[model samples]
Target: MGLVDTLTKSARRSSTTSSEGATMAAGYSAERAPDGNPDDTEVLDKEEGNLVMALISQLRIGMDLTKITLPTFVLEPRSMLERITDFTAHPELIFGAGKIEDPKQRFLHVTSLILAGWHIKPKGVKKPYNPVLGEFFRCTYHYEDGSEGYYVAEQVSHHPPISAFFYVSPRNRVIITGELKPKSKFLGNSVATILEGEDRVRLLDRPEDGEYTITMPNMFARGILFGKMLLELGDFSSVRCPSTNYSCDIEFKTKGWISGGYNAVSGTVKGPGGTAGEIAGHWDQSMEYKDKGGRKQVLFDAATTKVVQKLCLPEAQQEPNESRRLWAGVTRAIKAADMEAATAEKSKIEEAQREKTRAREASGQRHQLRFFEPVGEKYMPNIGVDRQVSGAPLAKQSPDEMARTVKEWLFGEVSTSPSQSVASGTQATPLPPSASVSHFGSETATMASTASMQSLNSVAAVPVHVTAPGPPVDGPKLSIPPPHAH
Candidate 1:
């Protein structure tokens, strides 16, 4: 949405039903606006703009650093449905009024919930709020440099987050479009914090020099998954990843630990799978293994043993001192997770492609995979109609009733105004023209913010550098401008 919808003081605040009540729908009202600067009014070069334009100009190519970074578990949307089925799974996280009554709906937890800004919610509650009917969250871009500008979302939908924050790039379907660069360093009420060095956060960091040496005291220290039974042992470390999802020649290294528990680490991670000296933290640490080409692998158990010794240092030195030797362990499960996620995403794309092919075959036309569709004067959904209405997608009760939820959620019926040129009887809209799609104007501003944030909290330099390519302005830089004083 534009400034009037997402950021305007007058915009209405809405909420989807809390699992607290059964059959309860969303309640909405105008919300109290936060006292902050407005969207862009002046021309901001990269440094001052908080608008999406400032973060990225164009989508980068190749495997995204984010796609392969951290554990593969971080890639796909979380399974919210499983929790809905078992309220006890995450008792404190439930809040929907509908969930409380229909035990079924509450049990049907989904990954995608509507992003509602209007609902009046109690502070510190984990259940994410959804927006109300007819009320759109307007966004106004205000550069910290005091510049002013405005842009609107393509259209409003149930998947507010997916629509407003991440659209598929018109130039590249694989590229996640739009910018989510928060105007401020952090969102005041975000339930999860990924700051480096903060024990409260799952992951935290502190930057040193040319590199950012990140240390996750115990990554996933207290995480809960389906199979993990009581206090189980897991790997932990930090990642200096590019904000965007694209692949490129990047560098990274981690040095944390492996306590005397069930196989500490087991995996291998190499940049783009094409870089040199590709090192991976593993559990097997096999002394020898043959490759497809029939050559024995180099740097096996011997190298890993040295890393294990380094990790054995006093907790203080292992986590705090870079001089203690920098060698982070990768795990096989972690590597499998990466492979599984990639396969899943690829499968999703391929299945989608096959369906399109069948549809075209039925119509006597060959399927043409066009990644980019011009949004000139019109906005279309990033995924396009090819995927919509395909299969028996839940056209049934609202999203709250679905078996699987997604990151995107909306609480009302969808209706776009001024639409024409019907496709499948319903006029197809372009993504940019809708008040929900076109926020990511550039990626540099996004990375610049990441770099600046790391600079402020880092204690050691991370030799491993990960950055998703941006609109080719001037490449990487030393520093981002200081926050503008109001």
Candidate 2:
């Protein structure tokens, strides 16, 4: 057998083996119970009514897919693959957290929740999966009680969903692998991608309006659009960031492919994007994003896209020249691409609990992010920009000091001159007469500018008071066509 086959066999063996730790980490003992042990019965009681009501209260009109509720403390839905896995690792805890009170009520509630939330769906036209709505539930409850339960809930059969893995360790010590499926009931897609320090990805379709969007679903609020990529976006594409969601313009041709097994049709993206790729024997890849800098580090500073690739190995081809084929058998036996890896089954209750808390409590106070919602340019067609943050204090300086003052705070280029105002009586240089009229309009104007967002026609010494992106010019601006339709 080839290396991939061997690895696959080995991985399968390990999972079935008593020593692989998945079963151990699952942390449940399957002691059989007497037949019809009434003690093991579960139901959805008055207590469960709270869970159902809470779920209904959190009901959003747009999440036409499944809806669920965990405790608190999760800021992003990016780690969903790992979180869902918790089912195997901590069955008891998961069962305990349901708060069903009676075993029969618990079973009914858990089973119904799973049926309502996780039923399988084939990935067909109109794929609507929301990764952000990871309000996951479990149908299979592991309550042995010495008796066998015959009831099985409906299963959610999703068509070829995408998964991405990132061996994310500075020294490769830990691998943060993630898997995602598209939920059609929700407006999401079936794509997944992972990122490291030097990865870039692109989408298959160019936006008709020269704009790309990064979105994050709000668990308690309307899903927010992070940014539109018409302007320079790659400038901020870093692997390690405060958030995992961001979009940017990429320099590349659509319908092209990456020879090193990468997809270049979307483009050679350097920011956070989810496109596609293949992994070792057991997996493949795709790409996407979440909101930026919202407690989830991946969603903050990194680009907002994920890629899904295949996990199976490619067949080896023998060159006509055979002298170099001396170790053909050996090379085929040990290639890294052909090696299969072990997968750990997980239980994701705690994961859900943590996510809910983060969404509810982590906004405004700790992490303030800039979405691309422009107050100045909204009405205009096809203008891409970052969401102008509201109530941001002004640049804190007079017209003469506009450029110098902003540069110092934003870039740390301190003024060499003695005249600098910094909340003190430190006398600043007197404003030149010409500087008074033209200072606010200068390109060097700071966030402190008086430009008012409401009046695009109005110009002042602040960002909110500036004139609009002004009426369309008579001449056409050079722009690229939509990447998707073509």
Candidate 3:
């Protein structure tokens, strides 16, 4: 049977016996502002009640959230595949590596850049749709400095929901690759999504040089059961350089249950010896660094850091399985504030995926991942434990070669020969522009400034390298730069 015919038959067969209160007659959409940010108004209380009840029925204190089915209305109008671009939001910190001569200082600068990215999140706490298997997202970055970056992410596994991604900056001669496996558990009043993965950044020109291993902090969806829904990050993460045996530990502290602070983080960067330096600040606000006995100075300011806009192929140019194309109808509906259309379209995708799974099972065939390859062991100390990390290798390649590869992947090739279809031959029609769709200008959020200098009570020592004159140029207010570059 044709795709529409199969879906229509399935819908009719299940329409008569649908569960009570399980399906809403219509979906609810949140009000949004001209800048694309959600407005102060809450989603329809009635619709939210239904979803909350469904969640409460299955929610245990420590229940695994990955297994639960959430209503589509609560989802953000984007896929997890596209969300990974947040890592490259601040390319200056990443590409600045070429100028730094000291390996230790370079390590610190890069690590700071990685930690600075968490503040670039959407204003609200809406969840992104879990990408379907073989789903892919690709976008390019064209910076004001005439630098360019390429990013591509693929959902490599479905069972455990693993995502693999790769990024390259030709101007910086830097490359980043990693896999993500998010494990979510429901706390009594909140949900904790522990990011189980390790991302690595390497200087392409220095192939034989060691890579920097970056870790992700765990996230908490606070007040999930009761009270206002708030998003907070907690737990601890680290960045380690195996070759230099240097490592840094960052602790994300959650606010007190009754009264306290939020978005706070403090850490220490040390080598083989004792403490080398200390970093303290709010991840959403600002971070300050102190080298041993040196005076505290600003390292990053989330309040004013400008995020670079990502360049993406228009919806029409994207392949069928690409994230934008596959979710176009749903995204368009969400953007238009048509929650009913969004939910209906989302259901179609999910139903189709279920059918594909059944067919593959009956044929005893397994879905194979394209673009990314599974690695035997990609784990670092506190990163993903034994989880498979899959991605293409960062082979030795000239800048020209890497650029060509990325271009071919984003745009089509010139060869007239036929090739394999993209992502199981699935196709979706594009949705037309609607009045609800708003192109909101970018807005910067000011993180609460709760971190104080008195909190810097750690032991202090003199800074070894003193070549830096001021803070990074990206943020004018930040004054303490890392060691000088070559």
Highest TM-score scorer: 3
Prediction 1 global C-alpha lDDT: 0.20
Q: Clashes in candidate 3: how many?
A: 4
lDDT agreement with native, every candidate: 0.20, 0.20, 0.60
lDDT by residue (224-300, candidate 1, tens digit) is 11111111113343322222111111112222233222222322222233321222323222222222344433222
Q: What value does the lDDT take at residue 31 in candidate 3? A: 12
Off by over 4 Å in 1: 1-125, 144-155, 159-162, 166-273, 276-486
Give the Å shift of residue 378 in candidate 2: 12
Q: For model 3, how does the per-residue alpha-carbon lDDT over 300-360 read when each residue is reduced to its tens digit? A: 6766666655545557666788898899999899889887898899888888888989999
The C-alpha stretches of model 3 lying farther than 4 A from their native spots are: 1-46, 378-395, 414-486
**Candidate with maximal lDDT:** 3
**Model 3: ten consecutive residues of lowest lDDT:** 26-35
If scored against the real structure, what TM-score would every candidate get? 0.18, 0.16, 0.73
- In the range 358-411, model 2's lDDT, one tens digit per residue, is 775766333221111112312110111112222222222222233232223221
Q: Stretches of candidate 2 above 4 Å error?
A: 1-262, 266-486
| Ranked candidates (lDDT, high to low) | 3, 1, 2
